[model samples]
Target: MTSRSRPPRLRPLLLTVTLALALAAAGCGTEPAPDRVAGRSSSGDPAPDRAELEARASAAQIVAEHVWVTEAAGYALARQSVGVLGDDGFGSSYTAPDGGMLQLSVERRPHAEADCTDGSAAAGGSEPLWTCERDGEQWYRATESGHAYAREQGELVITVSGAREKVDRATLRSAARAAHRADDHELDQVLPPAGDASGRQPVERGDLPPMGDGAPNNDVGASG
Candidate 1:
Protein backbone atom coordinates (compact mmCIF):
# COMPACT_ATOMS: atom_id res chain seq x y z
CA MET A 1 0.00 0.00 0.00
CA THR A 2 1.09 3.61 -0.44
CA SER A 3 2.69 5.22 2.62
CA ARG A 4 -0.33 7.40 3.30
CA SER A 5 -2.74 4.53 2.81
CA ARG A 6 -0.59 2.06 4.69
CA PRO A 7 -2.07 0.69 7.92
CA PRO A 8 -0.83 1.72 11.36
CA ARG A 9 2.02 -0.57 12.49
CA LEU A 10 4.06 0.96 15.29
CA ARG A 11 1.66 1.13 18.27
CA PRO A 12 1.77 -2.50 19.34
CA LEU A 13 5.40 -2.15 20.39
CA LEU A 14 4.37 0.37 23.03
CA LEU A 15 3.95 -2.54 25.44
CA THR A 16 6.78 -0.98 27.42
CA VAL A 17 4.57 1.73 28.92
CA THR A 18 5.37 0.98 32.56
CA LEU A 19 9.09 1.16 31.98
CA ALA A 20 8.84 4.34 29.98
CA LEU A 21 7.03 5.97 32.85
CA ALA A 22 9.61 4.72 35.30
CA LEU A 23 12.36 6.02 33.03
CA ALA A 24 10.70 9.38 32.95
CA ALA A 25 10.32 9.38 36.72
CA ALA A 26 14.01 8.63 37.13
CA GLY A 27 14.76 11.60 34.92
CA CYS A 28 16.14 9.37 32.12
CA GLY A 29 17.60 12.21 30.12
CA THR A 30 14.69 14.08 28.57
CA GLU A 31 13.06 11.64 26.12
CA PRO A 32 16.10 10.82 23.98
CA ALA A 33 16.21 14.26 22.39
CA PRO A 34 13.40 13.61 19.88
CA ASP A 35 15.61 12.32 17.04
CA ARG A 36 17.50 10.06 19.43
CA VAL A 37 16.49 6.55 20.51
CA ALA A 38 16.26 6.58 24.32
CA GLY A 39 18.29 3.48 25.13
CA ARG A 40 19.75 3.02 28.59
CA SER A 41 22.54 0.97 30.10
CA SER A 42 22.46 -1.35 33.11
CA SER A 43 22.90 1.73 35.28
CA GLY A 44 19.71 3.19 33.86
CA ASP A 45 21.75 5.51 31.66
CA PRO A 46 21.57 5.61 27.84
CA ALA A 47 23.19 2.60 26.32
CA PRO A 48 22.31 0.07 23.65
CA ASP A 49 24.16 -2.56 21.71
CA ARG A 50 24.26 -2.57 17.94
CA ALA A 51 21.14 -4.73 17.92
CA GLU A 52 19.18 -2.34 20.15
CA LEU A 53 20.05 0.58 17.92
CA GLU A 54 18.67 -1.19 14.89
CA ALA A 55 15.49 -2.02 16.77
CA ARG A 56 14.88 1.67 17.58
CA ALA A 57 15.47 2.60 13.95
CA SER A 58 12.79 0.13 12.97
CA ALA A 59 10.38 1.50 15.57
CA ALA A 60 11.01 5.15 14.64
CA GLN A 61 10.07 4.48 11.04
CA ILE A 62 6.95 2.75 12.26
CA VAL A 63 6.20 5.86 14.33
CA ALA A 64 6.95 8.37 11.54
CA GLU A 65 4.58 6.72 9.15
CA HIS A 66 0.90 6.19 9.97
CA VAL A 67 1.61 4.74 13.37
CA TRP A 68 -1.56 3.59 15.11
CA VAL A 69 -2.98 1.24 17.72
CA THR A 70 -6.14 -0.85 17.27
CA GLU A 71 -8.50 -1.84 20.05
CA ALA A 72 -11.98 -3.36 20.30
CA ALA A 73 -14.27 -4.67 23.03
CA GLY A 74 -17.03 -7.13 22.15
CA TYR A 75 -17.84 -10.74 21.34
CA ALA A 76 -16.23 -10.45 17.88
CA LEU A 77 -13.01 -8.82 18.90
CA ALA A 78 -10.03 -8.90 16.56
CA ARG A 79 -7.40 -6.26 15.75
CA GLN A 80 -5.22 -5.78 12.69
CA SER A 81 -3.20 -2.87 11.26
CA VAL A 82 -0.41 -1.66 8.95
CA GLY A 83 2.00 1.32 8.90
CA VAL A 84 4.96 2.71 6.93
CA LEU A 85 7.82 4.92 8.13
CA GLY A 86 9.01 6.45 4.90
CA ASP A 87 10.15 5.34 1.44
CA ASP A 88 11.67 2.13 2.84
CA GLY A 89 9.64 1.61 6.02
CA PHE A 90 6.72 -0.78 5.52
CA GLY A 91 5.22 -3.18 8.06
CA SER A 92 1.89 -4.74 8.93
CA SER A 93 0.32 -6.77 11.73
CA TYR A 94 -2.86 -8.83 11.60
CA THR A 95 -4.66 -11.94 12.68
CA ALA A 96 -3.84 -14.90 10.47
CA PRO A 97 -6.16 -15.23 7.50
CA ASP A 98 -6.30 -18.87 8.63
CA GLY A 99 -6.75 -20.28 12.14
CA GLY A 100 -3.20 -19.55 13.30
CA MET A 101 -4.40 -16.33 14.92
CA LEU A 102 -1.79 -13.51 15.30
CA GLN A 103 0.72 -12.78 12.54
CA LEU A 104 3.07 -9.92 11.57
CA SER A 105 5.19 -9.06 8.50
CA VAL A 106 7.87 -6.60 7.32
CA GLU A 107 10.82 -6.49 4.91
CA ARG A 108 14.47 -7.37 5.71
CA ARG A 109 17.07 -5.26 7.53
CA PRO A 110 20.59 -5.23 9.03
CA HIS A 111 19.95 -5.65 12.79
CA ALA A 112 16.49 -6.24 14.25
CA GLU A 113 14.46 -6.20 17.48
CA ALA A 114 11.59 -8.24 18.89
CA ASP A 115 8.30 -6.95 20.32
CA CYS A 116 8.83 -8.40 23.80
CA THR A 117 11.82 -9.17 25.93
CA ASP A 118 11.95 -11.10 29.21
CA GLY A 119 12.17 -8.43 31.95
CA SER A 120 15.42 -9.49 33.61
CA ALA A 121 17.98 -7.11 32.19
CA ALA A 122 19.26 -3.99 33.96
CA ALA A 123 17.31 -0.74 33.86
CA GLY A 124 18.70 0.46 30.52
CA GLY A 125 18.69 -3.00 29.01
CA SER A 126 15.34 -3.71 30.60
CA GLU A 127 13.28 -1.42 28.36
CA PRO A 128 10.64 -3.37 26.51
CA LEU A 129 12.66 -4.11 23.34
CA TRP A 130 11.42 -5.25 19.90
CA THR A 131 13.02 -7.96 17.73
CA CYS A 132 13.33 -8.77 14.06
CA GLU A 133 12.54 -12.24 12.77
CA ARG A 134 15.28 -11.60 10.18
CA ASP A 135 18.77 -10.10 10.64
CA GLY A 136 21.44 -8.16 8.73
CA GLU A 137 19.75 -4.72 8.62
CA GLN A 138 20.44 -1.15 9.71
CA TRP A 139 20.25 -0.19 13.38
CA TYR A 140 19.02 2.78 15.50
CA ARG A 141 16.86 3.47 18.53
CA ALA A 142 13.40 4.97 19.21
CA THR A 143 11.55 6.85 21.98
CA GLU A 144 7.82 6.24 22.38
CA SER A 145 5.25 5.63 25.07
CA GLY A 146 4.50 1.98 25.71
CA HIS A 147 0.76 2.52 26.03
CA ALA A 148 0.56 3.80 22.44
CA TYR A 149 1.10 0.46 20.68
CA ALA A 150 -0.87 0.50 17.43
CA ARG A 151 -2.08 -3.09 17.35
CA GLU A 152 -3.38 -5.30 20.13
CA GLN A 153 -2.24 -8.71 18.81
CA GLY A 154 -3.22 -10.68 21.90
CA GLU A 155 -6.84 -9.91 21.11
CA LEU A 156 -6.56 -10.96 17.46
CA VAL A 157 -8.61 -13.99 18.41
CA ILE A 158 -10.27 -13.05 21.64
CA THR A 159 -13.17 -14.41 23.68
CA VAL A 160 -15.57 -12.00 25.28
CA SER A 161 -17.83 -13.74 27.82
CA GLY A 162 -18.07 -17.24 26.30
CA ALA A 163 -17.95 -16.52 22.60
CA ARG A 164 -14.86 -16.33 20.40
CA GLU A 165 -14.50 -13.64 17.73
CA LYS A 166 -11.80 -12.33 15.46
CA VAL A 167 -10.70 -8.71 15.36
CA ASP A 168 -12.27 -6.61 12.64
CA ARG A 169 -9.51 -5.33 10.40
CA ALA A 170 -11.54 -2.32 9.33
CA THR A 171 -12.27 -1.33 12.93
CA LEU A 172 -8.59 -1.50 13.77
CA ARG A 173 -7.76 0.94 11.00
CA SER A 174 -10.36 3.38 12.21
CA ALA A 175 -8.93 3.51 15.71
CA ALA A 176 -5.42 4.00 14.39
CA ARG A 177 -6.44 6.87 12.21
CA ALA A 178 -8.10 8.49 15.20
CA ALA A 179 -4.89 8.19 17.15
CA HIS A 180 -2.93 9.93 14.40
CA ARG A 181 -5.44 12.73 14.43
CA ALA A 182 -5.10 13.02 18.18
CA ASP A 183 -1.35 13.29 17.82
CA ASP A 184 -1.77 15.94 15.23
CA HIS A 185 -3.89 18.02 17.59
CA GLU A 186 -1.37 17.88 20.40
CA LEU A 187 1.54 20.31 20.51
CA ASP A 188 5.11 18.93 20.25
CA GLN A 189 3.73 15.52 19.43
CA VAL A 190 4.56 15.25 15.76
CA LEU A 191 7.51 13.05 14.80
CA PRO A 192 9.64 14.19 11.87
CA PRO A 193 9.02 12.43 8.57
CA ALA A 194 12.68 11.53 8.34
CA GLY A 195 14.62 9.47 10.88
CA ASP A 196 14.73 10.50 14.53
CA ALA A 197 17.72 12.39 15.99
CA SER A 198 19.69 9.14 15.57
CA GLY A 199 19.66 9.65 11.80
CA ARG A 200 17.91 6.31 11.20
CA GLN A 201 14.87 5.66 9.05
CA PRO A 202 12.26 2.93 9.14
CA VAL A 203 13.08 -0.44 7.59
CA GLU A 204 10.84 -2.91 5.81
CA ARG A 205 11.45 -5.81 8.16
CA GLY A 206 9.31 -7.78 10.62
CA ASP A 207 11.09 -7.92 13.96
CA LEU A 208 9.80 -8.33 17.53
CA PRO A 209 11.61 -8.56 20.83
CA PRO A 210 12.00 -11.90 22.52
CA MET A 211 9.28 -12.69 25.05
CA GLY A 212 10.22 -11.82 28.64
CA ASP A 213 13.12 -9.64 27.49
CA GLY A 214 11.60 -6.40 28.77
CA ALA A 215 11.50 -5.22 32.37
CA PRO A 216 9.80 -7.80 34.56
CA ASN A 217 7.51 -5.04 35.70
CA ASN A 218 6.06 -4.71 32.20
CA ASP A 219 3.29 -6.76 30.61
CA VAL A 220 3.20 -7.50 26.87
CA GLY A 221 -0.10 -9.35 26.87
CA ALA A 222 -1.55 -6.92 24.32
CA SER A 223 1.20 -7.11 21.68
CA GLY A 224 1.80 -10.81 22.36
Candidate 2:
Protein backbone atom coordinates (compact mmCIF):
# COMPACT_ATOMS: atom_id res chain seq x y z
CA MET A 1 0.00 0.00 0.00
CA THR A 2 1.37 3.40 -0.90
CA SER A 3 1.99 5.68 2.09
CA ARG A 4 -0.69 8.41 2.17
CA SER A 5 0.31 12.04 2.75
CA ARG A 6 -1.60 15.27 2.33
CA PRO A 7 -0.35 17.73 -0.29
CA PRO A 8 1.66 20.62 1.26
CA ARG A 9 -0.75 23.19 -0.27
CA LEU A 10 -3.76 21.21 0.99
CA ARG A 11 -2.34 21.20 4.53
CA PRO A 12 -1.97 24.98 4.47
CA LEU A 13 -5.52 25.36 3.21
CA LEU A 14 -6.86 23.14 5.99
CA LEU A 15 -5.00 25.24 8.59
CA THR A 16 -6.50 28.39 7.15
CA VAL A 17 -9.99 26.93 7.31
CA THR A 18 -9.48 25.88 10.93
CA LEU A 19 -8.31 29.38 11.90
CA ALA A 20 -11.29 30.97 10.19
CA LEU A 21 -13.68 28.64 12.02
CA ALA A 22 -12.06 29.48 15.35
CA LEU A 23 -12.41 33.20 14.70
CA ALA A 24 -16.07 32.81 13.77
CA ALA A 25 -16.72 30.84 16.93
CA ALA A 26 -15.01 33.51 19.04
CA GLY A 27 -17.12 36.19 17.45
CA CYS A 28 -20.26 34.20 18.08
CA GLY A 29 -19.47 33.99 21.79
CA THR A 30 -18.90 37.79 22.14
CA GLU A 31 -21.11 39.81 24.48
CA PRO A 32 -24.47 40.97 23.21
CA ALA A 33 -25.18 44.64 22.40
CA PRO A 34 -25.78 46.90 25.36
CA ASP A 35 -29.40 47.52 26.25
CA ARG A 36 -29.47 51.23 25.47
CA VAL A 37 -30.45 53.59 22.68
CA ALA A 38 -30.65 57.20 21.50
CA GLY A 39 -27.17 58.48 22.27
CA ARG A 40 -27.03 56.59 25.52
CA SER A 41 -23.91 54.79 26.55
CA SER A 42 -23.58 51.19 27.57
CA SER A 43 -23.35 52.58 31.09
CA GLY A 44 -26.83 54.04 30.62
CA ASP A 45 -26.13 57.80 30.68
CA PRO A 46 -28.37 59.42 28.11
CA ALA A 47 -27.16 62.30 26.02
CA PRO A 48 -28.58 65.68 26.96
CA ASP A 49 -32.10 66.27 25.73
CA ARG A 50 -32.92 68.90 23.12
CA ALA A 51 -35.03 71.03 25.48
CA GLU A 52 -32.33 70.82 28.10
CA LEU A 53 -29.80 72.04 25.60
CA GLU A 54 -32.05 74.90 24.61
CA ALA A 55 -32.43 75.81 28.26
CA ARG A 56 -28.70 75.88 28.63
CA ALA A 57 -28.42 78.13 25.61
CA SER A 58 -30.93 80.43 27.25
CA ALA A 59 -28.77 80.37 30.34
CA ALA A 60 -26.03 82.00 28.29
CA GLN A 61 -27.87 85.23 28.92
CA ILE A 62 -27.15 84.91 32.63
CA VAL A 63 -23.45 84.79 31.91
CA ALA A 64 -23.86 87.75 29.60
CA GLU A 65 -25.47 89.96 32.23
CA HIS A 66 -23.19 88.98 35.07
CA VAL A 67 -19.95 89.28 33.13
CA TRP A 68 -20.50 92.76 31.75
CA VAL A 69 -18.04 95.58 32.38
CA THR A 70 -20.80 97.39 34.18
CA GLU A 71 -21.07 94.43 36.55
CA ALA A 72 -17.51 94.81 37.81
CA ALA A 73 -17.14 95.33 41.53
CA GLY A 74 -16.32 99.03 41.46
CA TYR A 75 -17.26 100.05 37.95
CA ALA A 76 -20.31 101.66 36.45
CA LEU A 77 -21.57 101.29 32.93
CA ALA A 78 -19.79 103.94 30.87
CA ARG A 79 -21.46 106.04 28.25
CA GLN A 80 -19.38 104.49 25.52
CA SER A 81 -19.72 101.05 27.03
CA VAL A 82 -21.45 98.37 25.00
CA GLY A 83 -23.06 95.07 25.98
CA VAL A 84 -24.80 92.89 23.45
CA LEU A 85 -26.08 89.32 23.55
CA GLY A 86 -25.78 87.31 20.43
CA ASP A 87 -27.34 83.89 19.98
CA ASP A 88 -24.34 82.12 21.44
CA GLY A 89 -22.27 84.74 23.28
CA PHE A 90 -22.13 88.13 24.98
CA GLY A 91 -19.55 90.95 25.14
CA SER A 92 -19.29 94.20 27.07
CA SER A 93 -16.62 96.84 27.63
CA TYR A 94 -16.27 100.04 29.59
CA THR A 95 -13.68 102.62 30.66
CA ALA A 96 -13.32 103.09 34.38
CA PRO A 97 -13.55 106.46 36.05
CA ASP A 98 -9.81 106.52 36.70
CA GLY A 99 -9.00 105.94 33.01
CA GLY A 100 -8.65 102.21 33.48
CA MET A 101 -10.44 99.89 31.04
CA LEU A 102 -12.63 96.88 31.76
CA GLN A 103 -14.08 94.38 29.35
CA LEU A 104 -16.20 91.43 30.39
CA SER A 105 -17.58 88.68 28.21
CA VAL A 106 -19.11 85.19 28.11
CA GLU A 107 -19.72 82.69 25.32
CA ARG A 108 -21.54 79.37 25.13
CA ARG A 109 -21.46 76.34 22.88
CA PRO A 110 -22.98 72.87 22.93
CA HIS A 111 -21.01 70.26 24.82
CA ALA A 112 -18.84 68.14 22.61
CA GLU A 113 -19.41 64.43 22.14
CA ALA A 114 -16.18 63.56 23.91
CA ASP A 115 -14.75 65.00 27.15
CA CYS A 116 -17.08 67.57 28.65
CA THR A 117 -14.97 68.48 31.64
CA ASP A 118 -14.55 72.13 32.67
CA GLY A 119 -11.26 73.69 31.53
CA SER A 120 -8.93 75.88 33.57
CA ALA A 121 -7.21 79.17 32.91
CA ALA A 122 -4.23 78.00 34.95
CA ALA A 123 -3.53 75.74 32.01
CA GLY A 124 -2.45 78.94 30.26
CA GLY A 125 -0.04 79.82 33.11
CA SER A 126 -2.36 82.14 35.00
CA GLU A 127 -3.36 81.42 38.60
CA PRO A 128 -6.67 80.26 40.10
CA LEU A 129 -8.81 83.16 41.28
CA TRP A 130 -11.12 81.81 43.99
CA THR A 131 -11.30 79.09 46.63
CA CYS A 132 -14.91 78.23 47.27
CA GLU A 133 -17.80 76.16 46.02
CA ARG A 134 -21.53 76.70 45.55
CA ASP A 135 -24.10 74.04 44.75
CA GLY A 136 -21.24 71.72 43.72
CA GLU A 137 -19.74 74.20 41.27
CA GLN A 138 -16.13 75.32 41.73
CA TRP A 139 -15.17 78.66 40.24
CA TYR A 140 -11.77 79.51 38.75
CA ARG A 141 -9.95 82.63 37.66
CA ALA A 142 -6.81 83.49 35.74
CA THR A 143 -5.15 86.61 34.39
CA GLU A 144 -3.88 87.83 31.06
CA SER A 145 -4.37 91.53 30.29
CA GLY A 146 -7.27 91.18 32.74
CA HIS A 147 -8.93 88.57 34.95
CA ALA A 148 -11.42 85.82 34.12
CA TYR A 149 -13.32 82.97 35.74
CA ALA A 150 -14.84 79.93 34.03
CA ARG A 151 -17.22 77.23 35.13
CA GLU A 152 -19.03 74.35 33.49
CA GLN A 153 -22.63 73.44 34.09
CA GLY A 154 -24.44 70.31 32.91
CA GLU A 155 -24.26 71.00 29.17
CA LEU A 156 -22.73 74.44 29.04
CA VAL A 157 -19.41 76.13 29.72
CA ILE A 158 -19.63 79.74 30.93
CA THR A 159 -16.70 82.10 31.17
CA VAL A 160 -16.57 85.60 32.63
CA SER A 161 -13.68 87.96 31.90
CA GLY A 162 -12.96 91.40 33.31
CA ALA A 163 -10.08 93.49 32.04
CA ARG A 164 -8.79 96.44 34.06
CA GLU A 165 -6.50 97.32 36.92
CA LYS A 166 -9.26 96.83 39.47
CA VAL A 167 -10.70 93.60 38.14
CA ASP A 168 -9.68 91.07 40.76
CA ARG A 169 -10.02 87.31 41.07
CA ALA A 170 -12.76 87.65 43.67
CA THR A 171 -14.78 89.87 41.34
CA LEU A 172 -14.44 87.45 38.50
CA ARG A 173 -15.54 84.54 40.68
CA SER A 174 -18.52 86.55 41.85
CA ALA A 175 -19.45 87.08 38.27
CA ALA A 176 -19.29 83.36 37.76
CA ARG A 177 -21.51 82.84 40.76
CA ALA A 178 -24.10 85.19 39.38
CA ALA A 179 -24.51 83.15 36.24
CA HIS A 180 -27.73 81.15 36.31
CA ARG A 181 -30.21 79.63 33.92
CA ALA A 182 -32.43 82.21 32.25
CA ASP A 183 -35.99 81.67 31.07
CA ASP A 184 -36.92 81.50 27.43
CA HIS A 185 -38.64 84.89 27.44
CA GLU A 186 -35.63 86.48 29.06
CA LEU A 187 -33.27 84.94 26.51
CA ASP A 188 -35.53 86.09 23.68
CA GLN A 189 -35.40 89.64 24.92
CA VAL A 190 -31.66 89.78 25.47
CA LEU A 191 -30.22 87.61 22.72
CA PRO A 192 -30.53 88.82 19.16
CA PRO A 193 -32.27 86.66 16.61
CA ALA A 194 -30.08 83.97 15.09
CA GLY A 195 -29.46 86.00 11.91
CA ASP A 196 -29.41 89.52 13.25
CA ALA A 197 -26.68 91.77 11.83
CA SER A 198 -26.67 94.22 14.75
CA GLY A 199 -25.22 92.78 17.91
CA ARG A 200 -22.19 93.39 20.03
CA GLN A 201 -19.32 91.69 18.30
CA PRO A 202 -17.96 88.78 20.31
CA VAL A 203 -14.77 89.91 22.09
CA GLU A 204 -12.30 87.07 21.94
CA ARG A 205 -9.42 86.74 24.39
CA GLY A 206 -7.03 87.46 21.55
CA ASP A 207 -8.89 90.70 20.92
CA LEU A 208 -7.64 91.97 24.24
CA PRO A 209 -4.03 93.11 24.57
CA PRO A 210 -1.62 90.51 25.85
CA MET A 211 -0.70 90.64 29.52
CA GLY A 212 2.71 91.70 30.74
CA ASP A 213 5.18 88.82 30.86
CA GLY A 214 2.62 86.89 28.84
CA ALA A 215 2.92 83.27 29.91
CA PRO A 216 0.42 81.69 27.53
CA ASN A 217 -2.23 84.33 27.12
CA ASN A 218 -4.62 82.97 29.82
CA ASP A 219 -6.77 79.96 29.00
CA VAL A 220 -10.10 81.67 29.69
CA GLY A 221 -10.12 83.53 26.38
CA ALA A 222 -8.22 80.93 24.46
CA SER A 223 -10.33 77.99 25.61
CA GLY A 224 -14.01 78.20 24.77
> What lDDT score is found at residue 103 in candidate 1?
18
Residue lDDT tens for model 2, 163-211: 4355556655655565544333333333333444332334456535566
- TM-score, model 2 to reference: 0.35
Weakest 10 consecutive residues of candidate 1 by summed lDDT: 155-164
What TM-score would each prediction reach against the true structure?
0.20, 0.35
Clashes of each: 56, 0
Best by lDDT: 2
The runs of at least 3 residues in candidate 1 whose Cα sits more than 4 Å from the true structure, single-residue gaps closed, are 1-17, 26-60, 69-178, 181-189, 193-196, 199-224
lDDT of 2 at 140: 40
User: How do the residues 121-220 of candidate 1 rate in per-residue lDDT, one tens digit apiece?
Assistant: 4367765443312111211112331122232222121111100133233433332332211122111222323344332323333343445553334435
